[model samples]
Each structure stands twice: as structure tokens, then as C-alpha cells.
Target: MTTGQMARAAEAPYYYVPPHSIYPIRGSLSMLATLLGAALWVNDFTVGPYLCIAGIISMLVTLYGWFGDAIGESEGGLNSKRIDVSYRWSMTWFIFSEVMFFSAFFGALWYTREVSTPWLSTLDSQTLLWPGFAGTWPNLGPAGTIAPFKTVSPFWLPTINTALLLSSAAAVTVAHHALRAANRSRTIFWLGLGILLGFAFVACQAYEYHEAYTELNLRFTSGAFGALFFMLTGFHGFHVIIGATVLSVIWWRVVRGDFTATHHFGFEGAAWYWHFVDVVWLGLYVFVYWM
Candidate 1:
């Protein structure tokens, strides 16, 4: 054999091909169970809540095992440079998909406010179709089926949450820099602070929801305004929760010295997701609240 070929053969394989796994099937089944159970529970089925809990538990366990395998593969140096590049591209596309997802909701909100409302107001049949109906933003329907709910203003809680989320973005950026500089201690500290800020944002949002429901009578069924308001904010809040959880896991990995300055795509991926969450919240603050 050639000298170079012999040397290459003596070294580890250049690429690590993962074996087929059942994680995807398990995950899908868990999600199906969770959705089915949630639907049934909402309809007051007796066994629905139990099934929902079981599904959630099973999903969590599956994730634990799946991530454990990934960690083992990564730490064992099975990932090649090609694999790292693939991971980066995968994360990029994932975030882009998320952007598109939010865009659809924002588009709906815009069309309802700018297009549909004005068009309906101009229709000659509107007066006859719904007496005393005004085609204004935040309308409560023609029949007055919805209660007189107040809209949430961008004064206190939302502003606070905005500040918290922005601060978290900054914190995570700093942590990323620290990680790149090989300062693991500083990285962990900043990441922890970022996580705390994320939690604070979630808490403030919960308080806002409480005030909206209890004090202002704002709710999911109040009208288009209420539905869009809750739908946008609620989904963003869910993303925040997920981003925080991912960061927490990344922080734990950092504590265990699982990443280095040159090879920490896992940390970078989580940071990307958190930053995307922060940006989405900014858009929400501007369009949903201030507008």
C-alpha cells in the first residue's frame, strides 16, 4: 500500500456514520399521545389527563436517552468537520423555519386589521348584516357575544418583559464571547444570568396574562383582538420557555467541561435559538403592544 494510504488507515475513520435509531418513531408516538390526550382532556374525558401525563413523561424520557447518545457520540470524537458543518446548516434552516412560522401569524394580524376590517366597514350590507356594528379594530362581533374586554397596553409588564428579554440576549451574547475566548467560568456565569433573565420574562408574562384575564376581561374568546393577542404572545412565551430550557442544558454541559473554544456547536445552537426568541419578542412588543 502507499505510505499515505497506510497512514490514513492507521488513523480513525474520517467520517462517523450513525446507526439507524427508533428515536423518531418514539418521539412521534409520544407527540400523538400528548395531542390526543390534550384534545380528550379539553373535552372532559376521564382518562385524558392521565394519558397526557404519561405521554409527557415518555417524551421526556426519550429525549433524555436520545441526548445522552448524542453527547456520547460528540465527546467520543465521532463527529468530523463535515458533521459539524452539517449541524450548523441544520440549525440555520431550523431557525429560518421558525421565522416563517411567526411571519404567518403576523401576516394574519395585519390582514385582519388593515384589510378585512376596512373592507367590511365600507360594505353597504354591513349595516343590515349587523346593526350598530362598527368595523373598528378590536371589535366584539356584531351580535355582542363577546364581553367588553380591554386591550393590554404597552406600559408596565410588557415593557418589563421586553427589557428582560433584551437583557437576556445581551447576556447570552456575552456568554458566547466568553466561551469563544476559552473562559469557561465567565461563560457559565453569564449563561446562568441569561437563564435567570429568561425565567423573569416568563414570570412577567404570566402576571400580564393574569391581569388581562382577571382585571381587563381580555381572553382567548373575547374577539379577533383577543385571539390574536393571546395566540401571538402565548406562542412566543412557549418559545421562551423552550429556549430557557435549552440554555440551561447547555450551561450544565459547560459546567461539565463538555465544550471548548473551537468545538462547541451545541452551545452555539442553543444561543442562536435564544437570540431568535429575543428577536421575536421584540417584534411582538412593537406590533402587538405598541401598535
Candidate 2:
């Protein structure tokens, strides 16, 4: 078909093909299993880990199958400018919703820091009764809980990880621009570097968490600081994983000639999402950790 014809064909309503699919259901099943496994494992259930592994493998298979089909269609010109536009809109809306979600968490943090914690600390009734009340975000117990129970400081490793994540973000931006310039090698190299940087951030976080639990005695069950730290940083880690995955996919697509300098919204959208995630982590660092 001519380019115009192919474009028109792609613009045809998706209904023409009858939207029926098994992947979505199958994918959900795998996710459910994995979620159950995680829940059970966290509670020290015996069967949880086995189910989680099985679920993860199943999910990987499902993703491979589904993405393979989409890739084939895209490479075959079945996807047109219209599909690209739709994806752009979809991704934009999805990211915007995520922004609002994170904003709510940030708002909660603001209220807690500025209003709730101070209010709770000054209550004479509590101090009169529970005399040892420390009134802190990360409440320590048993008077001197020692080194393990100490509050985490953002000065050392956390700062390093912050730099790592921000640097990776810049590298990803470079790679994105390289893609638009049709500089394949530059794109791949920068993207690969970004992925490495992402891995480094995750590794540092893993070590930090280990130290927090073992040496610092901070945990999700600890108190406000612990709760906020885990909630904000843990979610940010998940987003980093996703961003890395997107970058990896873009790298592979580059190798396969799936995108062009003129029309590669998929690559651009993923880049945008990664940058958004990076920005969120910046906010997390300032509000959740440094503040």
C-alpha cells in the first residue's frame, strides 16, 4: 500500500478488527498470583515464594507473547500515525494521573510535617501519661536503642544515589535527543549508560535499606519516618525499574529499525515517562528524605 493508504488503514476504527484478546486476562492472572505471593511471603508464609516465582515467569511469558505481536504489527506498517497519536494521548493521560497520585502523597507529607506532628508532640495529656514520649517522625523505643535504631541521615549514600539518579536522567535525555537525530550508536550508548545508572541507584537503595533495618532499626512498622520513607522511595524504585525497562525496549527497537527520526512517539513517550519518574524522585528526596 502507498504510505497514505497505509496511514488511512491504520486510522480505521479498532472496532473493525473486533477487540478480542486473551493476553490481558492471562496477564492479570499472573499479576494476581504474584501479588498474593508477595503478600504471603511478607507474612512469612511457606508457599508464597514458590508461587511468586511461578507467577513472575508466567507474567514474563505473557509479556513476551503480547509484545511480540505488537512489534510484528508495528513493523509491518499496520500501526500508522493515528495509532501513534492515540498512544501519545494515552501515555500523557496516564502520566498525568500518576502525577496527581504522587501529589496527594506529597500533600499528606506536608500536612504531617507542618501541622500534625507538632500538634501531636505538644499534647500535655500524652506527655503527662506516657512520660518517655520522644515526639519524632521515627520514634525510637527502649530509651537508648543504640546504633541499629538510630534515624537515617540523608548525608551519605542517599545523597550519592540522588546524584546517580539525576545523572541517569540527564543521560536518558541525551539518548532521547540522539534518537531524534537518528544517531543510533549515540542513542544506544546513552540509553545503556542510563540503564546502568538506574541499576546503581537500585543497588544503593538495597544497601541503604539493609543498613536501615539491621544497623539503624528503621522499618515500615517503625513510625512515621519509616512509613514515609518506604512508601515514597519504594514506589520510586518501582518506577525506576519500569523506566529502565522502557529504555531497554527503546534500545532494542532501535536495533530493529522500529522507529524513525520523523515518527517515534513510542520512544519519546517512554523517555518522557522516565523523565517524569526522575522528577518525582527529586521531589521524594527533598520532601521525604532531606526535609
Say which candidate scores most in lDDT.
Answer: 1
Model 2: per-residue lDDT, tens digit, 65-175? 887886666655666566767678999999999999888778877877677666656658356544555556545532534233566688888889889988998998898
lDDT of 1 at 33: 92
TM-score of each: 0.93, 0.85
Predictions in order: lDDT = 0.89, 0.78
Rate residue 216 of model 2 by lDDT: 74
TM-score of 2: 0.85
Residue ranges of candidate 2 with Cα displaced over 4 Å: 1-19, 124-132, 141-148
Query: What's the CA error at residue 61 for candidate 2, in Å?
Result: 1.9
- Highest TM-score: give the candidate number: 1
Q: Give the C-alpha lDDT of model 1.
A: 0.89
